[model samples]
Target chain A: MTQEVEMKEAQAPPSNSFSSASTPSTLQHLKEIASLIETGAYAKEVRRIVRAVRLTIMLRRKLKAATALAFINFALVQGSEAHAKLSAYLPKEDEHDMDVDTASSASQGFAKHALPEIEIYCYLLVLIFLIDQKRYDEAKACSSASIARLKNINRRTVDVLASRLYFYYSYSHELTNSLDEIRGNLLALHRMATLRRDELGQETLLNLLLRNYLHYNLYDQAEKLRSKAPRFEAHSNQQFCRYLFYLGKIRTIQLEYTDAKESLLQAARKAPVAARGFRIQCNKWAVIVRLLLGEIPERTVFMQKGMQKALTPYFELTNAVRIGDLELFKTVAEKFSSTFSSDRTNNLIVRLRHNVIRTGLRNISISYSRISLSDVAKKLRLDSSNPVADAESIVAKAIRDGAIDATIDHASRWMLSKETGDIYSTNEPQIAFHSRIAFCLNMHNEAVKALRFPPNSHKEKESAEKRRERQQQEQELAKHIAEDDDDDF
Target chain B: MDPRLVEVTQIFGRFKASLLRNDFVTSSNLLSQLKVLLTKFPSLPPSFQRTANAYEELQIAREIYEHAVLLSVKTEDQDAFERDFFQLKPFYADLKGLIPLSPQEYPILGLNLLRLLVQNRIAEFHTELELLSSDALENPCIKHAVELEQSFMEGAYNRVLSARQTVPHETYVYFMDLLAKTVRDEIAGCSEKAYDYLSIADAKTVLMFSSDQDLSNYVTEEHPEWEIKNGCVFFQKAKDSQPCKEIPSLHLINQTLSYARELERIV
Candidate 1:
């Protein structure tokens, strides 16, 4: 132990680090995190421990093999199992780095002992490194081991890291297309999280379960599990966003386009600006849902920053639907069939065919006072042997659905269009006014949501304390691993 | 095997024999008895209570539920079939690793999908379809139901009608026939609106009726509004005698004015 202290003293300078040393700042930041976790464990302040986990996100990106190896050896015990397993996943050098191993975690009570938080953090670090190296098989093995380790731990300080581990565990399994193998395991973990009241873990695992079920197209089971899982205030915005997105997808499949649109839009709005891919996905689904609901999405939705290229196909789809041209819709559907399938929007697009016909019929009704069913069918490009019959039925259904103000004159085989009414004189303007008011009220409520605080909880003198606490919470959100979902593999 | 498991197995065997023999009354009674007796074994789902012969007990219980689902199908009891299928689902879905794959699993799941399609429970049908693995989807029974759903959504009623003859399993035959009826009815509805009048022969072709008797029965019994005269079926559409109901513009304006006044007061 005395020899360890001497060794620590010798290596405590600004420069003399392990061979192939990373930047001094990275080493310094890691040391700060180790100290932070120490202080958090000593004081039993889970917030600080969570904050340390947040700081580790920055450390994760710059974590070279040597840097991670050095940090693990520094933070873990000399011969601990976690230390051995983690470094094994990293590429080792020809020369042994045993000289760096002398830095014991528990020495002279100066540099604190190994906390479970640090160990899980090391596991997270190494898991990320393996995934970055495209060693999914190794990453899968590492994450499962870490999850097993996480199960025995029930501390709130460990919840953040454990939640991250649960995510990576599911991600690794998903990357291997063996997600079904872990369904029971994820369900068990979800149960454990619920019993422990680990809200963050519960949230992440719930989203993972939903993703797992949706991956297989198991909407009934996914809906069942989601409905049965315990509901609580979300502990993380990223997880909440993921939950909303999945919920939107399930609703879309169930043909609840209104609810799907609301949730999908909310998810896009709530997602961090950096999560471009997630936002793009949300927008895509929202656009489709809106189109399915027969409400055209604004051009601005397709013109959002950084989403143009990804959304071009949807934009073209919307254009086809808007034009109400059957041939154009078919061509567009055929052209982007692969993209739609990969996005799982192919099924939703199939349902849009009816909407395309309705729109085309509406446009035709507006332009023509009276037209024969055969001529309408010819215009709509109904390429059937009995275009007149197809057009008659299509027009009747469109009229019944209130897509157009027209009556089917079956006796004459014509669709007689009604003159367009004055919108301002009708109740349409009143309903429009009511909707605008509702929107204003909703915006006001959301603003209040952002501005409200618990009554009488603010102490004037400790306002700084409250501000610091809030800042720490924001910092927790500041470096989310959720952004990786948007990263191109 | 435990004595309790042996009892369940015996009763399950009797239930299966009676169910196959078309004796639903006796089989249902035996099934109820087996359920009550099986509860005594603490090895079923949810708790999966451990015992010496837990695996054997769970396996037997699963088999019993599988038999119960088949019995419900044989009896044509939709409610009972739904209940039994749900009870059997945990065995295939959750406890899959604990037991070997059953041959009946895919066939039963496909039947459930077909039933949902027949019931017009498209939403539930999709939810259930999402649960299947790639291999399960590749099964002929599941693939048959999946293709039918695709054709149904794409408005290929002719394909849906033709699919009736090509059902993959015997149990599927019942749902496929029901599906064919549904498709014919849908086509009938669309045909009445699309055509002012159709010849009796054309009506038969449009509705996929093999005989004129069936078409006449459908027209006379179901659609009494249809008039068959001069050998042509005439759909008597209701004439629009009442003018289009104008939107209650005055009331809506009043409400809108009140809202604006309220807004002014708040401001």
Candidate 2:
């Protein structure tokens, strides 16, 4: 241990101790390096003892000591030659750790002890960790560096790192909302998946890729990928179920309604019954399509069955109102709207309920005098200048006129995302309009901000900005119609 | 015993006497009773073994009806004879010493039932069409039906086209006579036989003649004042009346489906 400490101390000040390394012959020094690693491994055993201290002792303190020992072992074994090469390129170990930790994560204390492979591993790990943490820029740099190093190796280490690259790339692109880049990386991963022929890897990569594709209305390519999707074994039921669920979406986009119904049903069946979340989503969509097909009796049966299951809180609320169960709809909607202050789902339910109220008011022969539409509107915060109001007016007019043949021209402004096109494209003036309605409901500010893009620009960039501006204006006007101006519709 | 029965006996006896000597008066009452018996037991004896060997042949008819169900016996059954067999089974069977006669049966009931079966087959076809509509066309069952229907329609069209070159001379003559009889019976069902003659006179002229002619010649011969033009026959009427003409045989045959639809409404 003393010799190992002496070696570290001597190595710490490289410029000052330039001639210190000529103290011993090559064979003897190699032996000394080997002994130092042996002592370092021994030090790990010593730190293991300190880990048993009471709760007041932070695990980080002991973990740092243990990592120090492991680093010494790594330096003695693999890092000697690697360190010599790295020394010319990198700063001293302590300073490098401080820089990486401060830049990436303050919590990654004592990262210096990590070996070259471990260091590469740590970068890959941090890339994934930062992505999960939503630190995309940090994750991107680490991921890029890991990818560079990964190209140099031919071992399973490279495979693991490459896998990490897929996840990091996927997460970072998703965070930055760069769906096109996300799509490219996902396609690259899919190619990797084909090369490896790893079922799990292919499924994971395809699921992410398909999600981006579906978001962007690139359904044809999504369908081609779907045809090549591997069947899920029983062990991978969740992944398989998710794959089928998205496949159903792709089928729907293709206008293959019956096939879509069958695929969605299959996904629901494969998904655990107790996983009410997925089941609810699947059932809600299935019912919506069935309803639009004029299969009212079927819609009723499905909605009734869905209500008993574990649907998302927002889905439950909208569906309850959809079925004309005003009491249940009000209860669920009020609770959901209050609980989620600025959530997308809560906003959607509020919008739907506001529409219901407006519809009731329009058809006043049925007598909605018992309920206070204004109070309900206030509770839903329909007064906010956002999409809910704009959408409500459009929907009410459509219902009054008996059909919606009009296109949502305002969508161009709102949908101009740098990453994903409007996720709400289908939702406006169409069957699943709730999603757009919900989006407008939850973050009207962001929705309004998105719509600030100019409407009349020939250039993609300028047009995108105009489109964003138009979207914000539309959202604001929609909010006004739904809330303060009951007479508007 | 009743005036209506006595009158019916007198009429039936006159009809029966035409088949043999005119000795029907003595047994007219018994024969009328036998006619009633024939109507009562229109089918064969329930059990063949219970009767003598002679009675075994009497049950040949029961076997025919069962065979009719399976579509095995095609030639023996005649519509008129079948009506008479059911109408006068006991009266005809009373002369046990004579050779046992084949029962004539209304083959239409059987054909109608078979048509019903065909309709069921069509229903199954419709189910496949529904499957196609539902995007389940790739189902093996649907694929098989589609292939089968496509083959059938193609084959049927080819056979119809090929058969148009060769006239079915014998069957054509037979069908002409059958059609005349069918028209007579159908017209009689609508009104008295006297009322049917005017409408059936042109049809009867074609049935009575053994001469062969193409549709144009047949139409010209049947209606001497008619002209054939564009595959149609038009006739000039007397100066004071509107023109009326018999349709050409070929045109009638071509429009047979329209005629059938017309006949269905009339019936």
Candidate 3:
């Protein structure tokens, strides 16, 4: 049984929370049970071990609970093959009632009547097990049962457990694309977390809400929530990484490339090595943001360990942008069209076409002092013939964007590169710098405004009341001091 | 008949009448009502005894959304246009077999293609294109966008600019004008580089402005660096104000002497 648990742990995703250490006694009992089953021990002995495992869980040995639940499931499978047939023969409603009846009867044998806490615990354990098994429908049903039972319980000790169940419930809705259901449940969970001052719960629920908003392309609502969400440092590295990544994505859409780049870089650097998929996604957006800011991404960005295969398309895209090859860019875009669409980076990539043209025109200007518009067209591979007008427009755009220093003569259809002295002395660079600083300052002010305080809590209210009393006492003391001074006069 | 279907039909009729009269305010209100009504009706209306009724319902919904998109365009409400277009998109995407689209579908789809191009959403442009039947590509409306995109991608700005004249639909004229403005701006930038000044007439012709006043207004608004004086548009400031760079005549003479010595040695 220990070996089986270890194998399962190894096979599970790195994000799974089951890697924490379990107690030695639990492992020993599990090992003994596995050996007993392997040696064809009697059903009574197996049932005794299962009861022992359940006792350990009831004793609050939380670490080994998953193993205990798995052992129980295994015992049921081995001791009563008829149980599966019974469940299969019954309707779903009847099956659920029968399971509950058996559980109640089993509990009566252990304790006079089943405790609601124990029932809730049993349901929660089953829900987690089903979720781990990728049985979403069964997990959904199990979570609903656990949540319903949780309402009758005192819930003070079980708030975290209830939050977990709600998370799984909403996750099931997400998997099914029941957007409205997910939103409603998440909102309820958010309200509960806010009222309880559960910082971690709030962060988790807010992240889920952000994911929903982004999935629906509702950035405005996501921004509103970001501003209103309480400011607490995320307790988990994974959650922090996700928070920064979403912030970066929102900033990118708003055209705040500098801040977006900073956030994306931080997210990429802080992402766990095991979370290769998340890191790759961060790097993809980072690459695009960098390109948008007219900076070519370093080649090493694409060569990051474990991300090489995933970053290949973006690398080709960066290469096309760097070389300013319109034809190559088009080919790359068409080749990886599906990948871009799936990643939802297609819009950003499309914007890169203008960048490519700018770079191409800039290079052309540097190489030639004066060239006919027709020749320019040929060099840019714009058209086969009579491309003078097209070439003029492209050159015009290049000049306007400050990508090139050149002028067009209409009658002669010639483009002349500006003298080096004329290009550098313009006030454009200063204006550009000022605008960038203004943008940074604006973002800083926005961030300051967005910072949220914790919702009013009993402790905060008590502190406030104490402060008010202290202020009043100080005023009274000052009044007495003034009276004494008057007497002295 | 389903009461919801009857209401939808009634609202759609009002929407059509408002659109025909160019009453955007009334039309927009009716469209919102129709949207709400349609949502209450099942995607596959259950009251319909035949599958054909469901298909017809889908067709009516599609037409309503398409009209909403057109109304949004006519009013120049881009946000509404985008929302309406997305609502109409599923009908085009999913009901291909159940109900064939009307002939107007291609023109509107093509107009959307142009809109995407103008907005620089090339990836979505391709995605939408991929959803169409191969024969749809041959439609004049779709072909116009495909050719324009090809030209734009190939650096054939002239072709893209000229494409404005041959746009397949009236709705397309808006995006075409936007593209023309983009092209004209590009040309204006190049003109600043190649000449110190151009005659006002020549500037007007190169920038594709129809009249002198338009050219003058464009220069005043967009190109503050440009100076119009004495029938010429000067790209740079007046000659006296221009910064002069000192020529290195001694360096040039020395280089020429060195080259002359090398030639004498070779002879």
Best by lDDT: 1
Task: Quote the positional error of residue A175 for candidate 3 in Å.
Answer: 5.6
Q: What lDDT would each prediction earn against the true structure?
A: 0.78, 0.40, 0.67
Q: How would you encode candidate 3's per-residue C-alpha lDDT over A55-141 as one tens digit per residue?
A: 332322232333434333333332342234223222334323433344334433332223333333445545554554656676666
How much lDDT does candidate 3 score?
A: 0.67
Clashes of 3: 9
Clashing pairs in 3: A390-B158, A396-B186, A396-B190, A397-B186, A406-B193, A407-B193, A407-B194, A408-B190, A408-B194
- Model 1 regions lying over 4 Å from their true place: A1-21, A90-109, A376-391, A453-489, B1-74, B84-110, B131-267
Output the TM-score of candidate 3.
0.62
Worst lDDT 10-window in candidate 2 chain A: A50-59
The collision pairs in model 1 are A217-B130, A218-B130, A218-B131, A220-B127
Instruction: Please state the Cα-based DockQ of model 1 relative to the true two-chain complex.
Output: 0.24
Q: On residues A1-489, what C-alpha lDDT tens digit does candidate 1 reach at each position? A: 012123223323423433344444575678788888777877878777777766765555555666677677677876888878887887765453542343333233345367898888889888877766558899999999998898888788788778888887888887777999899999999999999988988999999999998887788879999999999998778789889999999998898889999999999998877676678889999999999999899999999998899999999999999999889999999999889877777767877887887788788888999998889988888775566765765675565445777766655678888877655654566567788887886686677669967676745666788879867767655545453332211
TM-score of chain A of each: 0.87, 0.40, 0.63
